[model samples]
Target: MMSSSPESRIASLGLTLPSGATPLANYVPYRKSGHLVFVSGQLPKEVKEDGSAFFHQGKLGESCTVEEGQAAAKACGLNMIAQVDKLKRPAEVISRR
Candidate 1:
C-alpha cells in the first residue's frame, strides 16, 4: 500500500499546525541557502483552540518531569514545522517520523 502523506499523517494523529511564531527579538524564523533550509530554534509555544497562546514553562529537571520535558520538545518541533510551512515551497519537507 502507498504510505500517507505527511499532512495526512499529522491530521490522523489529531495534530494541528499552529500559526508561525513571531520572533521575540531581531531574527527571522528560517533561512534557505540553496537546497538547505536552516530553521531557527523554536520555543514550545502553541495556539490553543480558543486562539490563545500556550507554552511550557519552568526548568525541566527542577520543576518539570522528564515526560513533561519531552512533551515540550514535541511542541517546539511542531512550531518549527509551522515555520517551515510558511516558506510556501510545495515540496516534501518532512522526511522522518
Candidate 2:
C-alpha cells in the first residue's frame, strides 16, 4: 500500500488528522497552558452509539476481521487527533501513575 506522505494519505482518504487523540475517560482530551498542547490516550470506537463492536478481548486474526480491525484502529487514531484539537496550546497532563 504505497502512497504519498501520511498527511497526504489521510487527505486522499478524505480525512484530516486532528491535533491529537480524544480522551476516553471523563478527563478533557487535551490541555493548554502556553503555546503548546497536550493530549491523552485515544481509542477507536463506532462513531454512532448504534454501531456494533463484534470484536473485543479477541485477537484480530482469530475473531476480528481485517476490515473490523481497520475500523477500530481508525477510530483510535481519530480520538488522538480530537484530543490535540481541543487545546489552544500544550498543557501539562497529570497521570494516575
Candidate 3:
C-alpha cells in the first residue's frame, strides 16, 4: 500500500531525508527521519539571480512587520526549491541510493 504521508512518497522516490540544520547557539534549521523532512527557525534567504540563498536577519515585530516576516519565510522556501532544482538529475541521485 502507498503511504498517505507526503514524506513517505518523497522517500519512496529515493531521496534520503535531510537532517535538521542544528545551530551552534540555540537555533535550528530542519529535521528528518527516513524519508520525512522538517524545517524550522529560518530567516529570509536572499537569492541572487545566480541562485544563491543568503540569510538576511531582521527582527520581525520590531524591524519588520508580520507580513514581512511571512515573506521572508516564503523566500527561504523558494531558495530551497531552487537548490533542489539545480541537482543534476533525479536518475543521478536516486540511482545512487
Candidate 4:
C-alpha cells in the first residue's frame, strides 16, 4: 500500500498551504507533549509577497456578512493547518474548538 504525503494531499485538494506565522505575543505557537500537540489560536491572515499581512478584521455579527464570516473562518482554519503542517508530521485533526 502507498501512503500519500501531507503536502501531496494538500496539493491534490487544489489548495496551497500558506506560510507559517510568527506568534504575536511572548508565547510559543505550539506545544508538543508526548503524542499530543496544542496549537495556539490563529487568525484569518495571509502574508503577502512584500511581507504585509492581509486579513479580514471585523466582528462576525456586526460588520461582516454571513458569507464573509464563513470565508474568514475558512481562512483561519487554513492558517491553523499551516501551523500544524510546519511540524513536519502527519496531523489528524480531531476537532476544532
Summing lDDT over every window of 10 consecutive residues in candidate 3, give the lowest-scoring window. 88-97
Candidate 4 differs from the real structure by a C-alpha RMSD in angstroms, to one decimal, of 2.7
lDDT of each: 0.80, 0.58, 0.50, 0.78
| Decoy 3 TM-score against native | 0.36
Cα lDDT, model 2, residue 97: 38
lDDT of 1: 0.80
TM-score of each: 0.78, 0.47, 0.36, 0.74
Residue pairs in steric clash, candidate 3?
20-30
Per-residue lDDT for 8-88 in model 2, tens only? Answer: 767788986544533447897655656655555555543454644332234689987898788777776666655654544
1-97 in candidate 4: lDDT tens per residue?
A: 7899877988898877887777778987777877777888678876678978789879888998888888787778788888888775745666654
Candidate topping TM-score? 1
Which residue ranges in model 3 land beyond 4 Å of their true spot? 1-32, 38-43, 50-54, 83-97
lDDT ranking, best first:
1, 4, 2, 3
lDDT top scorer: 1
Model 3 CA RMSD to the hidden true structure, in angstroms: 11.3
Global lDDT of model 2: 0.58
Q: Ten residues in a row with the worst lDDT in model 2?
A: 49-58
Q: Which has the better lDDT: candidate 1, or candidate 4?
A: 1
